[model samples]
Target: MLGPDGIKDIAKMDPREGAALLEAHIENFDGEAAMTMWLQTKPKILYKGGARSRFAAAFHPRENKFEVEVLFSKAPTDFHPTCNQIFYFGEELELALKYAWWAENRVPAEAACVLQVALPASKMSEGVYVDDAKRWERLVWHSRRVDSHGQPLEAAPDTVVSLLNERILVGPICGMSPHVVQGLPRGGWQRLTKIRLSNNQNATQVVFMNPRTFVERCEEILWVLSSVSWRGNSSQDLLVMHGLRVQPLNVGQIAAS
Candidate 1:
């Protein structure tokens, strides 16, 4: 069976051998509940770059699907990406086998897997949502409380220009006259204002814009992952600078019963 120590040697083993080891570990558990309990052990595994990898395995009973996530650490102070990679399989045994195979063959040579654990599917999803909500709340509060100068807004034109530059007043510039909007910055703000006006059907238009803030971008990535189908083999450049690899595997046969 594969233990925490065995992960370091996985790179040297044939992909099939690594797969078999994972399969053996999965077979020891009776069901999803049993597997979740076993995962509480939180095995610490090391891969390349001496970075630790954390693992999260989850089974969605309603979908009859299994998911394994490998989250990598960047720095001691940096928040780890929600997941560095995600592997989905139709069967539990298949999940274990394909995950082992991918870890052995595909994970970059310099990468490391720091944390690993199992979780219920519902809990995993809930955690993601909760984290995102907190971030969104924080973003909204920041937007409302301060202008681009990082201070409270005043009636000054400079403060308005600062807000426009930071994209705080993205929609129709309420309370401000057309002359004031036109008097602001010349390049991006001018173009954005024209675009908004051309699309506006009403005098008081409320347009929603994505500031592409860090939190917003994170939400977009998560939405894409959750909405897509993950049956075929594919890869995504999810935080490539951090050496995270997201991919799928083709399973020929079940390795465990």
Candidate 2:
């Protein structure tokens, strides 16, 4: 109902031919309101890295699985920490969708209409590291069910017990009703999920069916995204997972650490 074809065929058409159709589609599909809100809402990005790092990423926890996002920018010598985990595969960022629209849309109009989002470098997953600090420190920000490569592994257990031995902080999933108290991270049983270390180079990404019991407030799930500059190296020759808000740790009251 939101796509172009759902209402009418306009996904691919001449700018003039689809111009009116796109407009109508936008109006009918609440595209305008959503766009306006998206434009107006100031999406807040929760970064889990200190100011010193050249790049950072975070996760967003929605329902079953989590989505991780990262960002690259310039930093100065005088930088401070702005995240929970210090040594990680990558820093985390908490982005509120509403908070982003306003910030992005307000930019001054340029001669050419353009939209762009920076993604991570692909084909860099062999050693399973993304951030320079992470690679240098051999930190495991996030990991799939494999070692450094994409090959499937069996270390990841379905239950939390498997992670306990690794010293990685284990938690519950974020979105669920009557949440499953204690279970495995297999199949659809996952929830808000937690982060833990599998080795020095990587961390495990598991989901839970119950989050409230484990985590106070869940918002984003931090993980690394695969991206490369316009023209960069080959896809991740290794494996790498960054960070995002897997289940946004509720930071209602700032606690003194």
Per-residue lDDT for 1-257 in model 1, tens only? 22133222332434344334444443332344333332442211112112213232222323323332222222110011121222211112122332344454455722222222222223222121112323332222222333444442222244333333331111222223333433444222312221122334311211111112211222111110110012233322111111111222211111110
Clashing residue pairs in all predictions, respectively, total: 11, 66
C-alpha lDDT of residue 77 in model 2: 6
- Model 2, 1-257: lDDT tens digits are 11111111111323343233323322233334323322333222121212111222132222332222223111110010112221222221111111122233346411111111112222111122122332211112112223334322343333322322232221211222212311334443233223322232233212111222112222211122222211222222011121212434332222222
lDDT of 1: 0.25
Predictions in order: lDDT: 0.25, 0.23
- Name the top lDDT candidate: 1
Please report, as a residue range, the 10-residue window in candidate 1 with the lowest summed lDDT: 219-228
TM-score of 1: 0.19
How many clashing pairs in candidate 1?
11
- CA shift of 235, model 2, Å: 12
- Candidate 1 at 158: error in angstroms? 27
